[model samples]
Target: MAYRETVKIRDRKAAQREALLAAAEGLVREGGFAALTIQALSARAGVGVGTVYRYFRAKDTLAAEVFRLATEREVAAVAEALQHQTDAAAKLEQAASRFARRALRAPRLAWALIAEPVDPAVDTERLRYRAAYAALFEQMIEAGVRAGELPLQSPTLSAAALVGALAEALVGPLADHQADEHVVQQLIRFCLRAVGAADPTAPEVSHEQVC
Candidate 1:
């Protein structure tokens, strides 16, 4: 007869894996992927280093997993923001603001996700997620063009450019932890102009309202 794992054993294993992942995420949040070593994860999770190995066969795999988990949340946020607004221009502006605001809110983690030097595996994930963001922007840009809300442009190129621009603009400020509402507001205006949308009537968004 073949041996089988019981329900209790499977549940316990799942819980342990989640705990390890949560601890790994916490370490990345506080100090970036540079701080996420198997031994460090063991200490944080209060498990043996060998246990971390059980969940993640290698360090690169672990780093990539953490990157994917954190970046998915950010992408979802921008997508959600886009959905909430009525027009293509408003959706673009709101999505840009939401992304910038969230990055400012978590500068350290944002820096890690945006520009940290890590293994090749993690870099691959970064490129994939950047494309994910661009895809979201591409849809909106295409809609705006069709609706006559935006000037004629190549949505693919424009969307990719917006992702690159937003990342580059925030890298310096995010690294220094100086990003704020002003930066977010500027980003919104920049994205609007880049996409040929109307400028925001308000000089700046109220920090009180945005944050």
Candidate 2:
């Protein structure tokens, strides 16, 4: 007889893999990335230590996978939020707002993904995801410039600046804890000004709306 796979066995294996990843994510959420070890992850997932190795070879690999998964999900969400908006400035506003809202709501996860010092392997993964985020802004900036909605500037550079500004502002102790609404607004306004996006809501010469 030829070798064949059973649906039941494949489903069970898939479920176990998901469980392991979930446990890794939970550990990072609760205690940051350093807390995710093979023994600790096995305990958290209610699986044997060997089982974790079956799914992932090392802690850094697992941690990097978790970061990729989370960031990919956020990318999809921001993309969806930007579907209805036509103007580049409005698209930038909505996209930045969506990213800021999620980061502010989950500060610990945000911190780990944004600025937590980790293995160089994981750092490489972080840079990849950050580039993914910058691409979103770059696309919007290009559209804006073609439409004459924004001044002529290097979209790639502007995108990188916006990504850095947003991540730093939300991640470290540099952030304020009160009034998420106010903070999100400030971040959006900064993004518009940085891109020279000409929106009616953008404060040109006022100190009040700048904050």
Candidate 3:
């Protein structure tokens, strides 16, 4: 009986932690990290501030967790896009289009993930996820080169540049709350051109289908 009770307590604590994290992510989705205070999180989660502290020792810790959670979802979406298409160029296009469409769908969250001034912890997470994106692109670029879809070039550098281009291109528009398919198409074309892919025609990504 004691062992069963212990298991239940552990499960309950885990659920509570997940709830707090979910609330933290919601706050960021609506207002960015600046709005993710412990008090605010507790209020949103219907818990005491001390309860929040019990899960996360500091605001920076909490903010970093939120960043990690949000970035992982973004990365996974792009990864799925890359995996869905067989052609290397097509994979790159799909991944880029997916990223841009998702960003346009949630500009506030995108800005927070991309360019918002944040705590050191959150910034560290941002850099790590940037590398994660570059790694994904690098694999596609290498495959393109292998398949003769792209010219001979350094995949690592090209991948980093592509990631930078996508993020930088969206910064101004995302900040301004502008949702334009033209922008996403341009971004896809730009990435293909930069990688020296032939016939770089970018397909339209619908704002309605942004996931």
> What TM-score would every model get versus the actual structure?
0.92, 0.91, 0.93
- Report the lDDT tens digits of candidate 3 across residue range 131-197: 9999999999998899888899999999999999999999999998875898897787778778987
TM-score, ranked from best to worst: 3, 1, 2
Per-residue lDDT over 73-174 for candidate 2, one digit per residue giving the tens place of the 0 to 100 score:
888899898897999988988998899888777767777888878988889989998899899889989888888999999989998999999888876442
Worst 10 residues of 3 by lDDT: 202-211
Candidate 3 Cα outliers beyond 4 Å, as residue runs: 200-211
Cα error of candidate 1 at position 150, Å: 0.4
Model 1 lDDT tens row, 1-211: 1235577778899999888888999999899899999999999999999988989999999989989988998999889888778777788888888888899888888899989888999999999999999999999999989999889999999999999999989999999988988888778877887888875455354555333
Instruction: Output the TM-score of candidate 3.
Output: 0.93
lDDT for 122 (candidate 2): 85
Every candidate's CA RMSD: 3.7, 2.2, 4.3
Off by over 4 Å in 2: 1-5, 173-179, 200-205
